[model samples]
Target: MSEINPSQITFARVRRRLTKAQLAKELGVTSRSIQNYETGSSAPDSETLAKMAKLLNFPQQFFCIEESMPVIGEHAASFRSLSKMSDAMKNCALSAGAIAFHINDWIEERFNLPQADLPDLSDLPPEEAAATLRRMWGLGSAPIPNMIQLLESKGIRVFSLAEEAREVDAFCTWHGSKPFVFLNTMKSAERSRFDAAHELGHLVRDVYSMRHGETRGIEMEREADAFAGAFLMPSESVVANKPPAFTIKYLLKLKHYWGVSLAALAYRFNALGQVTEWGYRNLCIEIAKAGYRTNEPEPMEREVSQLLNKVLDALQAQKVGRAEIARGLCISVDEINALTFKLTRLSVVPADSSIDLVSRRSPGLRLV
Candidate 1:
């Protein structure tokens, strides 16, 4: 067997959301030993390796495999709440992203997934960029019925954050040629849609610059928010449908049509100069009074990944189960679940089950 990379041990433990001391306690070792192991100053013996593998729910072979490409970086991820998040939380999210990169690679090798079709809009303004992407995707000014499905069809891989990291809103990163967006699904669907579009902005506009060390700033975040507004509710469509005067009731009604949060709609109206600053401030105050700041009214259904569902279904047809995939990746099934968006359904075929069972259980992909 190949020698283990110390970094792999750290990644495995961190991916499990374990502190060094916590993992050390579980492994019947001192925290210093765990630290040494992770820092390459010492190596664990066979017995220690076995304990680690069992404790971390990863195969010992996982530690021996060569390190994966460095997919996560400080500049790689465009965080929605970078200032509010802690280092541990950030590392946890980035580790999840690295796992996603591996999972995507595994899936791509077996399936004919959609190639990314986004155009370069780095130089354009956010609204123009959003408009251009919609035009390229042939979306026009129509409201997207399902933002997750739309992103999947366009070859943007989307994943849900682990429930533990509820502080993060959403983030996106580019891994090689693919764009990956991770959403915090605990939020309202409307908020998640906006987040999806916001991350989409980062992936399309800031990805290349991020690699060049132009890290995401306040300006970039504002640009992304603008993109999300224009993408979700086009100015032309808003102008055509909006009421003469912006009211909380009118904004609430419009939120349903645009599938955006009421607050986002109000902000968009203000940005478009349809509502005066005073009106916008009053609308915000009213929206807060109605408790739409944290929880909005008339929440839309949460969007899920269509591409992952199809891929998993296809694998099920071939007698490949989630457990098998997890084993192949040397990770736990729960870890796989964390890396996918609401991947709860597993098509299991018993030893005596007929081949017809596969066909009966698998649903056809819903291509938009």
Candidate 2:
């Protein structure tokens, strides 16, 4: 029989946001014993192991699986607000990334997903890079109808951030050649779209290629925000359709056109010099007074992942449901659901639906 992998214990603990001391207390063991078990110097007894599985909400087989887990360190990911996130929050997010790696691999084995087509724009300024990428993708200053679909179409793996990691908006990281973006679906729809575009900025600008945590610096955050503004609301489009005045109502009317928040649209115009400094300050004051900062007016519906939706639908056609996937991966179904919450909506595939369950190339799932 295979021995339990010690690292899996560490992963489960981190995923549950529990410290070694906490877990040891829950399992009725000493902290040193937990440390020893995690370091492979000792193994948890059967009773202790069962308690661990129960406490951590992981399947017993998860501790025995020999598969290697993906590593995502603090230096590797480009987080939006790194200074505000605690180590526990960051570890919880990274743990989700690790689980996503396994789920992505499982999906890829059954379907030919789109390959990465993002460019490296580290040499250019944020706005110029956004323009260049738009031209490269042939998106010619048009409003992106669906940011999630656009990202998935370009081979970026999109996932939802669990509520435990909600303190930070979103983050992106590169696992080998595959780029993954995790969004906090709890945010407003417009904010979520901006978050997706902001992560794309980090990816294309080579923020993850930095030497260390420099990717989380304030300047880098500004660059990513600038990139997101320019990418989502192109200068040409915003200029041609500039509102009559800088009134909050006028700005609110145009925000839906670009699928961004009213404040974002106001800031964009101000950046372009369309609104004077005083005018911009007044706009900000009005936005805050109207509570637009906290609550978006006329919010749109949250965007779901097209790639994951299609993959899950196709997988279900072959009798592979959430429970089966969880069992195969030695993970609990709740963990899987948490990773894909609001991003994947499981639907029944009609008997007459034209889906090729045996073939890997199922129409829209082919490589680009």
Top TM-score prediction, candidate number: 2
- Weakest 10 consecutive residues of candidate 1 by summed lDDT: 350-359
C-alpha displacement of 289 in model 1, angstroms?
1.6
lDDT of each: 0.82, 0.85
Model 2 C-alpha lDDT per residue in residues 1-368, reported as the tens digit of each score: 26989999999999889999999899889999999999999999888898899999998889998875777977788887787888999999999988998888877767788989998898889999999999999999889989999999999999988777888789999777899999988899999999999999989996436424453568888999999999999998899988888998788778888999998999999888888999999999999999999999999878888888887877776756777777767888787787788888854433343433445553448522
Poorest stretch of ten by lDDT in candidate 2: 348-357
TM-score of 2: 0.93
Error of 2 at 125 (Å): 0.3
How well does candidate 1 match the true structure in TM-score terms? Answer: 0.90
Q: Candidate 1 residues 1-368, lDDT tens each?
A: 57978888988887677999999999899999999999889999999999998888778888887865354877778899888888888888888888888887767666667778777789899999999999988998999999998888887888888766778898888887888889998889899999999989887788577666566689989999999999999999998887867887677788889999999998888889888899889889998998989987888777777788788778777677767776667666776777664633544543342233323443344466
* TM-score of each prediction: 0.90, 0.93
- Cα RMSD of all models vs. native, in order, equals 3.7, 3.2
